[model samples]
Target: MPSQVEVMVKALSRLLGWIYTFCWSASFYPQPIYNLRRRSTKGLAIDFAAINVLGFICYMLYAASFLYSPLIRKQYAARNPISPDPTVRFNDLAFAVHAVILSIIVYSQFWPQIWGFRVSRYQHVSWPVAGLFWGCLLAILILTVVVVTQSPDGGSDPAYWAWIDVLYGLSYEKVLITIVKYCPQAWVNYKRKSTVGWSISQILLDLAGGVLSLAQLIIDASFQDDWSGVTGNPLKFLLGNVTILFDLVFVVQHYILYKSSGDGEDDNKAPDPRTPLLPEEQALQR
Candidate 1:
């Protein structure tokens, strides 16, 4: 158990964590939106999209299983006090829907690149089906998910199956994918000693959010007497805040190198793929 002053500091830590996280969420759009409008993914890393797909799939599982989760039911009842019935918990189905939608769109993000091992990419699939399928799925998924997660017990640990689903399903293949697909690209970029262009703001925010999350962990440790990640929910307890520090540091390293070295763009830039590859760029598939 932490002392009085420690508790206060922990509150501040949570506040900071949430602030940065929300900022990160807000930041998600601008870069992608900009990329779409500009029709260029110049500075964007494919790993980001891949990880997001994994996260959404995890969210889907996280949201769908809440109704059956006894731990969640208990927590929700405790928080609400008024609505203790199981029927009140029926609204917990939205998360699964969102997860599916997010997964679909996440695939769409890379669809152009991967859509065609066959024909030209633009001719691969009907745009309408792809778009509408994801849009509807996301809408239904989000509504139900929000109803549950925000209902006082939203952040409760996942059910056992949900835990397993997320752990195995959302294994970020970004780093591995990067190694396989982009390693050669990275080597070429390194030879030129620059990123053909990776989005600066996105990576920067990813780093910041990771740091803020770590700070939140430290604060939680400072205030909580038990300080055990070992609750009924072992995954959240054991590995919930995992990899955040490394993520932050990794992003910082990239940002600093890019900042100091100046843009890798040349005076006569003629759309050479090798032009923007960074000397240090490699293995971000995770």
Candidate 2:
């Protein structure tokens, strides 16, 4: 029988897991809402959305691996037969799947706005090209996972090296994806000297989710002594922290540093009578 403390910990872990799942899932929507309201994706990076989709896909795979990996499932069953499922709840899977869908919606918003910006050269790469590149990379990763996990030697043992290969490879891919996912948008914001089109609400929600996720990890580590929950998947440990850091940076940029910036705001401002207006501005004034 589990101790009272252990039971309490398990309950707390489940509660935190659901909360974190909801927060993380909901966080993906604010940016899309911001884009739709503004009818612009200026200051937002398409690459960020692309990479976000890939990252979420990798995370989903990692989560699903817990369900399918016999080694992991067996360990969980041995440890706690009553609730032996190692997989995250279906709700968590829904959250991850929704995030990916939201990312695609956000990615779709980029092109329409980019078309409106009459610049000599587009700042970001072509969307289709970027999409293809990421698609190919994801395909390669899937193939590698299938090949390794299907090996005869790998199937012979739950603790086979190939199992570790799949687990760690997906985990590391998630880490890499998370590390680079925010860079494009951050760079754009830096170059533009503002985070105008980006939603502050999105950052706030993401920060909330990240903090909660980290707390969930702490709860697991404290109650279960599941260091492997983190060490085995350092990305899972680091993702929330890194996201919080970047979200804070974005908050500072949007609210503190660019508080007085006229870049995004100027889009709605009336044309100055004293200054000659561009053709587009003249049409808008009429």
Candidate 3:
């Protein structure tokens, strides 16, 4: 039986979780909306979009496996022994699925013919970045095969189950992606000296989401009197903080760094991607 205070605190944590989920999920919208309205993906980094989709797909798999997969959950319990199942919650799962969908939409806008949007000549996923993501995805597939093939007989040795480690590997990969994904966008902004076409709405909402997520984790751990919920899930914590750090960088880049007339564009605007190229440039495009 739980105390009334305990019940109330748990409810509060649930509320916070939902709130952060909304914020984080909503953060995915503005960029695609901005692109749709402008009919262009100018100034947007396709590399960022490309890998963002990949990261969220990994996150979705990790969240879903820990939340729903009996085998993975059993293995997790075997390792933790005392700890409750992995801290992945319904909100986390919801956010990951929602992110995957929205990120794919945003990434599609990078293609001119696919989404009926114009893209800047410079807008492309660099071969190195593309290859890196391909390698990461290939690694994921190979590990899945290994886990499937190496699966042993019933109750032989829980330690031998590779799926648990594979799930954790997915989470760790997400953490790595979160750390690196923003670099391309930030570099693009810096090189252009502008934040145009990179929606600041997403940045502000992402910041809110990241802060609220960390707060919810802290509150949940304090109320439960189990710091393992926090310490055991360092990658989750890192995801929230790293997202906040980069969102702040984008906020600064949009507001203080490139803010001239406060429209999230530079004073001397970069040439529009939708502008008709000169005849020679069009010929080259053909």
Candidate 4:
């Protein structure tokens, strides 16, 4: 029932939503990769690395469900709301293959512990518990895909795919935990009156991403109950809105940190270049 232009706009909207949802790598890859290259782990939390390597599994599975799941269109006026056209079956298969490959990248982050591992032992995970869950999901996912694809019914249920997404979201809980721990360590380092081990750049980018994504989610959620694709998804509305608010805390904290660092720099006394006056200084002056 939706017009051509409307459909295209809505489709584009949804595409952007999906893109932002998987923007985890965009958030993580830059700093971590840079740190690894420079070997300057300063201001980089080891826990973030460990949890991140482990968290990739969750993110990848999430990416899998997202990339593979059928999208129900929100229409202008329709009893059954969806585009009548058949989604490409083969494309799903191919994308699913790529998902499997990405999963390997996720799983490979957790292998035999050797110094060659980019993550330090202090920062690397001792137990890849999150990694294991993602690995299992990946295994089950392949089997599920093969069977479902071969079956009479093409894999088309959003509900079925939602489980993987659920797991994926759940996996981020540990990432939050790791970040929480790292934040305190960050605070402690600065408590001595210097932003000694903090990277304001990282926090700034995080704030920027969080804010924009928050707007995106608000747009998505405002339409959830509408069932009209034009409005967007309501669940996205709730989660995205909440995230925007909570992320503000970090923004404030980082701003305060920036100011404090300036104060610390100013408070540091210059080296005393003046030579000490000897006991005979009074006689010399006379």
Return the top candidate by TM-score: 3
Task: Give residue 237's error in model 3 in angstroms.
Answer: 1.3
Q: What are the per-model C-alpha RMSD values against the true structure? A: 11.5, 5.5, 5.3, 10.5
Count backbone overlaps in model 3: 0
Local lDDT at 232 for model 4:
25
Off by over 4 Å in 4: 4-26, 33-38, 69-193, 227-247, 258-286
TM-score of each: 0.47, 0.76, 0.86, 0.48
Model 4, 1-286: lDDT tens digits are 8789667655655665445434422444444344434434444444444444433444344334434444422111122245222221232233334434443443344343421334334544334444544555575566556546654445334434423334334334433433443454355344534443344444444445445445544443343433332222222233334444534544555567455443211222343467454346657987
> Which pairs of residues collide in model 2?
none
Instruction: Give the lDDT of residue 97 in candidate 3.
Output: 94
User: In terms of lDDT, which candidate is strongest?
Assistant: 3
Candidates, ranked, lDDT = 3, 2, 1, 4
How much lDDT does each candidate structure score? 0.42, 0.67, 0.82, 0.41
Q: Which tens-of-lDDT digit does each residue in 146-174 have in candidate 2? A: 75667766433444434545555666767
Looking at model 3, which ten-residue stretch has the lowest summed lDDT?
Answer: 260-269
Q: After best superposition, candidate 1 residue 176: deviation in angstroms?
A: 9.6
User: Which digits, one per residue and each the tens of the lDDT, describe model 1 over residues 1-286?
Assistant: 8788877885686576566546455445544444454445444344444434544454445434445767655653453344342221122234235434544553465555643212223322244434533554564456556545555545353331223222222222222222232233233334444443444454456456546645555455434443331232222222224334434433444455444444432212444675554334544532
Off by over 4 Å in 1: 1-10, 42-48, 59-68, 72-107, 112-192, 230-286
